[model samples]
Target: MTGRFAYGLRVHGLDRVTDLMPAPPGDDLPEVTIRQHTGPRPVPEPLDRWRQVRLLADGRHLAVDRRSGTATFHGPPLTPDLLAHPYLAAPAVVVNRWTGRETFHAGTFVRHGRAFAVLGSRTAGKSSLLAALAARDVPVLADDVAVVHDGGVFAGPRCIDLRQPVPGLALPGRTAREGSRTRVSLPPVATHVPLAGWIFLSWGPGPALARLPAADALGRLAAERSWPQLPSDPAVLLTLAALPAWELTRPREWGALEATCRLVESAAEAAAGQPA
Candidate 1:
């Protein structure tokens, strides 16, 4: 199977082809090709880790070694959104990492020519805040993951997600057109976002926001992905170092989301002032 998607690439020679980016401008080939391994799978190097999906990275290509399809994804009703999107999207992250890029579980939005990225674990108020920000017509650069390369931010898949829906708050999936669930969508971003800053979301009693030292921010980023030591480590560390970052503490109060957004906005403005 084969297809194309955003982010300059294609899906080539795979059994169960799903969503793909449109070829880069002029029908360029995919950044990496995927093929099923019917023979014996390659043994992992001493440091390699293979959980549900096996990720192999080398100078030639980023490979996804798998036996299951989207059907194997255990979840609620088998909606097209759950089936088609995640299968391709998740592997792409490891692929980017293999290519010496850093990917984050971030929801990124552009405002006034600058972009703000929110990063956190599940239910850390990242998605709830995404639900709120989308209400104000902020263009989301990426969701689920954001790829950082050459001082800019590129879209992952459009995922305006939350643990549970909040009343009176609308999100991406609600107004999705036919097939939107299965297909990937990003705002018409003709160019990458000049990433202004990243906000690390954490939960606690106090909602105070604070600046993160470069070293501390770098540590948090590496810790989140459990990034293994490899030749690619320097590039990943350099990418995180180039950006300004902050830790946005979510107040335990249920009503604090709005205030947190305000704080995030301020942090973004402060980031905009820095050199990219």
Candidate 2:
């Protein structure tokens, strides 16, 4: 059975059709194709591109596409058992012919400039921090997983993400036309930045900023990572682990903005090899 999505979504990874296309053997990587369709029927026009976002706790999402005849697993720490696991058999989205395997679990995000990412738990002020950085004209890198490759972070999709700010704070020019979820760009930014420090953030009733030891910051960031089980390249992980990380408690009313600016500036400087 071809596992196509009910929506007329012709974009890659959004529907079940493209999810199931055949791939080269021994390598479990998706040969993605973005095409257009009309109400489950393939459209002659070029397919518009879009992105699919998945938030996994413990890494467990299965996808299958019938039109292309493919199946895949999106949860973290891709394992051999992922092939036969019952949970991996069912997914939030499914296509037919495509099949691939990823040893790592990564959430998707489109790029803006250097692929910057914020790793933190829910309510940890990740989105707010990113918005603040955008306000400072740093460019929205990725609100979630900022996938990093050899030399730069990968931008695979461009989407618009508009969601609510942290509980108490209100974002300027926020619109309710769409749901609470932010609209991310579809065509991802291809620009790659040299590996920069991954910043870790925290908030509290009182305002204070402290530069955490590199080790401590890495540990904290590690805990907040999306997938801890994936067997990733040791060198890449090591480099990320060695890079500096920051932990800043939320600042008081007017102080929050200043603190955010300082933190971003510090990160930029660190990335640029300037004194912080």
lDDT of 2 by residue, 132-169 (tens): 55555555544444445454553322222345543333
Q: List the global CA lDDT of all models.
A: 0.56, 0.40
Q: Positional deviation of 20 in candidate 2, in angstroms? A: 21
Cα lDDT of candidate 1 equals: 0.56
Candidate 2 is scored at a TM of 0.54
Query: Which numbered prediction scores highest in TM-score against the true structure?
Result: 1
Q: What is the lDDT of residue 139 in candidate 2?
A: 56
| lDDT over C-alpha atoms for residue 195 of model 1 | 75
User: After superposition on all CA atoms, what RMSD does each candidate show versus the true structure?
Assistant: 6.9, 11.7
